[model samples]
Target: IIQGYGLTESSGSVASTVGPEESKAYGSVGKLASHLQAKIVDPSTGEALGPGQRGELWVRGPLVMKGYVGDDKATAETVDSEGWLKTGDLCYFNEDGFLYIVDRLKELIKYKGYQVPPAELEHILQSHPEIADAAVIGYPDEDAGQLPMAFIVRQPGSNLTRQQVIDYVAKHVAPYKKVRRVAFVNAIPKSPAGKILRRELVQQALSMGASKL
Candidate 1:
């Protein structure tokens, strides 16, 4: 099976892994579709990035919508005057032009000066044998700006500790991306479609008013 990427605003698929050869790229969603022009842009600097650089994927094409109906403000923020639609997804193109989605642009954890993708940490946390599910969020911190915090659900009868979760993620990621705090939850809040309801967790964390797990 092939993977693809697009949104309702794009009028359907913008990129897809076509044949067997391109499908070999594994995690990539393939190259841009015909009549579609795409560019990777640095979200912070708005500078166009080259291949292998992780940034927001912007696309322009006939297939793209004119604007959101009755929502000019939202339309203006999403689609630029020049017609490039900011996909709001953090992605990168490989040397072969295959697109690799990292995570949602807004969901990134800002730790110190580095941008850490929470999905990366969540993936590591969920990989542990004792972990049933996991979600990562940007916890508030004065000095670090934000620290990577994990809300984890342990496997049945498992007794995983917060430090164990931290160490597991630390081993798989850089020092900046380490899980600084962990909370063992019965279940992670999620949408009906299985997307993590991170805002809820963030609010819960704030309500708790404690940094320690």
Candidate 2:
């Protein structure tokens, strides 16, 4: 219900969507808390953005970890020049204080020059009538450097093919956003925190290559 974003070092409690009736907005994560302060910084300029805008999410609070115990380089890279905690999540807060997760800052693929967000593609794939669940990831390609590939789980007793999935994405997303490859899977791998293990899928798409249904 109440979804908030934070890093593992922060104890993963900086943001959470919690409340009995909060489940209505299934995709919108909830806002910050008494001890938490969040701001959006433009990845390129490091300028802060207002509500309803998207950017890299930053957090500052006592709950945030100073850095890794021994990984000073990793800690320095993540904490940045300021004391803010880099959450590495692309998201926005609505005017009413609801947070909406867009995608991961690191997972975005570059096509020619455009940023292709895998989470956006995955959301579209999951919306298909026949799809039970879906995961989208970027794979290396010579032309564009990287492209999205969707792995889907279909509804019980339903039949869907690679081409059908491809056509479905084509119908819904922009040409650049359309998934270049698709693989039907028994289920989409997820973590205990409900996060998809996209890195694994990216590896699979590389070996499996893009194929039409």
How many pairs of residues collide in each model? 0, 8
RMSD of 2: 2.6
Report the lDDT of model 1 for residue 62. 96
Per residue, candidate 2 scores C-alpha lDDT tens digits across 111-150 of 7677888878877888888999998877787988877777
Q: Of the candidates shown, which would achieve the greatest lDDT relative to the real structure?
A: 1
Task: Provide TM-scores for the models.
Answer: 0.95, 0.84
Pairs with steric clashes in candidate 1: none
Whole-model lDDT per candidate: 0.92, 0.80
List runs of model 1 lying over 4 Å from the truth.
Answer: none
Clashing residue pairs found in predicted model 2: 2-16, 2-17, 2-18, 3-17, 4-15, 4-16, 162-213, 163-213
Worst 10 residues of 2 by lDDT: 204-213
